[model samples]
Target: MALHFTDVEAALDHLLARLPAGLRVAAPLGLGKPHRLLNALYARVEADPSRPLHLYTALSLDPPSPGKGLQARFLGPFLARHFGEDFPRLAYVQAMKRDALPAHIEVEEFYLQSGALLDSAQTQRRYASLNYTHVAAALAARQVHLITQKVAREPGGDRLSFSCNTDLTADTVDAHLARGLPRPLLVAEIDPQLPWLGGSAVAPDGFFDVVIDPPGPHPSLFGLPRQPVGDADYAIGLYASTLVRDGGTLQIGIGALADALCHALVLRHTDNARYRQVLAALDPDLESHPAVRDSGGLGPFEVGLYGCSEMINEGFKRLVETGVIRRKVVDDAALMRRLADGTANLGDHARLERDGEYLHGAFYLGSPDFYAWLRDLPEVQCRAIGMRRIGEVNQLYGGDEGLERLQRRDARFFNSCMMATALGAAVSDALEDGRVVSGVGGQYNFVAMAHALPDARSVLMLRSTREAHGRSESNVRWNYGHATIPRHLRDLYVDEYGIADLRHASDEDCVVAMAGIADARWQAGLLDAAKAARKLRGDFAAPPRWQHNTPQRLGQSLAPFRRDGTLPDYPLGSDFTAVEQRLVRALAWLQASTATTSGKLRIAWQALTATPGRDDEALRRMDLHAGAGAGTWFQARLLGLALARTARDH
Candidate 1:
């Protein structure tokens, strides 16, 4: 029987009394972290400098800090509304940000919340570079003293569920046991809001040494507001969608691009004529591309798809609701093989029901709506989604390689990258200067697995261009210093332009394919570099079709669909209201405009000439009023111009 407590301080006292002085604690990443308990522990350690503390984790969830000026004013109310006003933030994270950690205290992570700790030198220095599947082993190696996470249970139920995270807890505990190490103290904080899940997510009896079921009024789960998808995102998504084979497997990362891809997949299944129209508008000859012709299709999914991903984001949920993610995979290898070969009897519904699952994911973090959907799912429907361990979801050698291979047939592992080289290296996780943007979680595993599997391909998606210092720079380059996925493992690369099939292609062919997908402005320079390096033919000229790969052209192609609701900005539902959505666009425009000196001057000029004409609602939402101050007036005018510009462009 686990010791139960109603107060976090009592649990802290118990931990302090039992654990050693040099406390090494492990917490689950993302939504699974027990913030209240962790906060209390951190407070205790901070107050007592004699006790050294070491915290190991990844993707520590921190609510967005409302910064100064217009951005802060706009976000403050929204943050409080979305994440409760009393939401518990990790004290160690704040201490690290302020560079005020005690001399003996340290915080290390496998993955930093995407660029959150970029400027925090302490965090960057203590960062651990490990794959998602390797985190458990790393924890065991560190000989962590405690493993604590928030868990779920039904009202007055004895059983516990790992809920949003089944990523590493069991694996870490098992790894420790296998290594003949002492069993780490297991602690669980019961949060009523967490959805009760089954499969590998259910914990065995007496799994925890301590359980803290605090009194009511629990804080809301941190919800990631849906990002607005741009024209480039839709173009990239449409191209990527064509590469999905019917009845294939999908593994997508999270973000606007992933959402766009899911939206495109839904459209492909529901309104395929519009899908083809948008594809044609993007590239008239897209269907004839070898990657599409050989490995992809531009048709509705008759057999649907099975999802196997590390992060079960909101996109997967939408895909499921749209009937695009209905292909069920059973755990039995023999059954899977028989089903694949049409040898198994279709009439045996009982066995199928016992073993079938439409999706297998390690963890989930998404909007509140997604959580509710999972919480309210019928038992039968809930069983269709299996929350497994990261090792099982990310790799092939875990439990049953044969079963995994059968289940992941025609797999397309889709992930986003920051940049890629013309020769086919991907820069996904870090910068050239050895600064980690986000640690390599599972991109490499999925990419390598794609190669190990006979009929699978890893699709690395990136926008063709990004705005840096208010100027468009090509993401496809001739060379880059760092690579998360090197050229040797190069596979499918997708941009707004098209997909580059570099699987087994030679240097020259890879150059051509990569250049075909580069922005039109940068294509010539990339090819010139390739030619100078003697990697490409000097006589080869850029294709005429590739020259039209520009944002203007992409916007023109997708504008009609965006108007007709075929391609929505928030394809998944949004927490942001209509006015807030408009403000988000305007604020994005303002940020981009202020990125360069010339752009800043232009914005200043616009502010001087512009008037805050009939946008009272947007102004009131931001709390900007007439005659507040010069700074306020200038901000109002600048925002007015931005709103007008975005509106006109749309």
Candidate 2:
């Protein structure tokens, strides 16, 4: 039987007494962290320098703390409302931010929350670059002997569930046991709010060594707010959606682009005529593209799709609710093969219901509404979403390759990247100067799996341009120093303009295809570089048809749908109120305008001469009043101008 305690400090005292010095601990990433117990342990180690502690984890959750400024005035109240005042933050992350960590302690993570730790030199130095599947083995190699996680159980039940995270804990324990080493100490912190899931997420009562059952009113689970989608995102999503065949498998990551893709898929299923109309406006010849002809279509999904992704966010929930992700896959290989070949009869319906799952994921993190949906699911609906191990979800070489291949037929792995070279290399995780923007999570595994599978393709989405210092820079470069996915594994690439099918294509052909999707201003320069390198003919020039790849063209094509309410900014719902949503747009505009000297001067001049009172509601939301101070007066005026600009553009 597990040793259960109700007080976190008492549990910490017991752990310190039982474990050895120089303790090495591993915890689950994202929402599965046992915050109370970990915070207690961290406090103990921080107070006594003689006791050393090392923590290994990824994606530490922290509530938004917008510093003192106009931004803070706007976001302070909203953060309190969304994340709750009692949301548990990782103590180590706060210490690292202030450079207050003790010399004897160390914190290492395989992945950082995207762009969260970019300026923390201490964190960047200790960052571990490992794929999601390889994290367990890496932790085992480091002799991680203690595992702590948050778990869920019935009101008075004995069984435990890993809840939102079944990604690495099981694999870590198994890796140590397989090496003939002693099993690591397992600790669980019970949280009533976590949903109890079955399948591989269940654990027996005796599986844990210590269980902390805190009193009522537990801390809130971390929730990621939904991002607004833009014209470029919708255009990219529209092109990517055309490449999904009916009854195919889908894999997507999180962010605005992924949400946009989900919206496009839902549109394709529900209002296919309007979907096609929008697609035609974006790209008239998209249907004739070879990639679309060979592996994609432009019709409603009669058989629906099966989702197999590493992370299940709100997009997947929306897809499931809309019946766009209803293709069920069973665990038995023979049954799956029979069903695929139409040899199985309706008599097997009972067996299918017992073993079928429409979606398989390793972990999940999304908004609070998504959590409630999971918590309130009916038993049968809950069973259909099987949470498995990271190894099974990310790779094909797991123990049951044959069954996985059958389940993942016609797979289209869609992911996002920051930049791509003209010769087909992707820069997703890091900058050229070796600064880690984000660690490589699972992009490489899916790309490799797409190559191993016979009928699968990996599609990498990129925005054609990004704003840097108030000027537009092409994301498709002629050459780059860093690469996450190299040219040898080059596959399909998509942007707002179109798709570039580079699988098995020549270097020259790859350059031309990449140029076709690049911003029109940079296409000629890209081709010129290829010609100078002797990779293309001296007479080569970009086709006249590609010259219209501009943001104006994309916005014009999608503006009508946006006006008619067919396409929306927050299709998946937002936590921000109506006034706050307007503020978000205006703040984004202000940030972009302040990125350069000339733009800053222009904005300052406009603010000095701007008329006020038109944005009183927005000003009141941000708590900005007249004559508070010179800074406040200037901020109020600048914000009013930004609001006016965004409103006019809308």
Candidate 3:
């Protein structure tokens, strides 16, 4: 009578009997392998050829071309087979980071309506402005049965045909029972997160009459490329830090710039420890947590931080484990006690208070191990926040609050733009004819919010230069036709070279200020171009010392710190394999020095001789490929060819 493996089939059958006939079920696009219940449904669909229940999915295949990414890998072949050839059934995934929306959604109606004069209510009613909204509507119209790996506690009513609450632990089961599920349910008594710790509880442990302890599928994995912080990043970090009141809340996105902003805070504490200390003492629990003492030499200003991001990654956990985010001054002990009991929401448990504001992050990405730790934490005051709320709060409380409210205030916002011109336009990605590479997600919202906040500031991080023709060139001077945030809105721009404050500045001042932070190698060229175009009113010359402020120099300066473990620049929970790590380091070295001096050439030759792996081959081949025409690479390759010929002659 006990729920066991045999009970699973029976339990599923019973649930199926209760469901309305001909109901179709769809799972989250990326949710791993089909459960036995889903497998059973597929078998039923195949056996009953007449009433084939169609499963509408958000999954899609990568484009046939090389540039197109992978598709249908997350879901099992069962769903893929049905949707692969079937029109209208689709799967959705992130095609690009600049826009939160999928690439396929046609925004023509939204764009066309922007031109028309319509009331706000009418506009809201008519426009499906974002891709996700379309996804929701699609599912709703199909009347499709949807299942999710992690369902938001309440996703409205009667939409789901079947839900498998698959947690088997005692506590998890108890939690599930309390929720009082009225829908058709197929419960699996087997533990879903068994290999992990005890704190990770599941929902509704005893409600399932059938238990299936079958091996769980592998979780989806993602990769993140390591990028260096540049001049523009430094500027943004500094300005954004200014927005961070001594003990305010923070919600940061991931990337090199995010890392840079954190590093700048470390640097700020180092530069002025006393000021930071005074700030920290104001917090309720000033001297308790280890993060204040252990994390990267943070001083008295060891500002307690809580995360509020959608994607919780290793960086956030590391901050907690290492103690940068553990210092909490609980305002409501009863609420904390509720979280400890695991009865409250998961979001609240993750919220950490510092100074006065609660710190919570809604965005993050990490390995299963990292998430397991988060899974155990009590939901104190944390909540899963969305873009709509993000836009709303930022617009409401940004800078209007007093300094006390501001410092304990969550006023700073850090974001990135793809291209920012001297003329005040920003673009997240390149635009092509009649098509947008990226859609406006929350940039406009955040910018507007920053402007609305009394103490808030919008800091834009960018690099001074980019690599081209086997050499680095100033990105500031590159000709761009796209714009996302315009020049007039530009506040603080940071690169590895330096920071530039551009708000309300003349175009010339903006260009000069921006040029000052350009890689020293390209500073003169930028200045000369500005002069030629009459963009600069005064000095046409830049000092040689300033000209050397390239990414290469910044990396060189930062390298020793990394080697000694003084600076933790490595990506948290690395996606870099061993071979990739070597390639990354070698590539960084190669980019750092352009010297074709005899000593440098000797070193390069030795490296090629000693390690003739794919990495070396790729490096050599890249040089040859880039040198195919008349450019710097061509000159370097030609010289090498000449030197080889002379050696043969000798």
In angstroms, what RMSD does candidate 2 have relative to the true structure? 1.4
Number of clashes in every candidate structure?
Answer: 0, 0, 62
Residue-wise lDDT of candidate 3 within 478-508, one digit each (tens)?
Answer: 3466666656677766555554667667878
Worst 10 residues of 3 by lDDT: 65-74
TM-score of each: 0.98, 0.98, 0.54
| CA lDDT for candidate 2 | 0.90
Once superposed on the true structure, which residue ranges of model 1 sit more than 4 Å away at CA? 347-350, 648-650
Model 2: colliding residue pairs: none
Q: What overall lDDT goes with each candidate model?
A: 0.91, 0.90, 0.42
Task: Flag the better candidate by lDDT, 1 or 3.
Answer: 1
TM-score of 3: 0.54
In model 2, which regions exceed 4 Å deviation? 625-627, 648-650
**Which prediction has more favorable TM-score, 1 or 3?**
1
For candidate 1, the lDDT comes to 0.91
Provide C-alpha RMSD values for all models, in order.
1.4, 1.4, 13.2
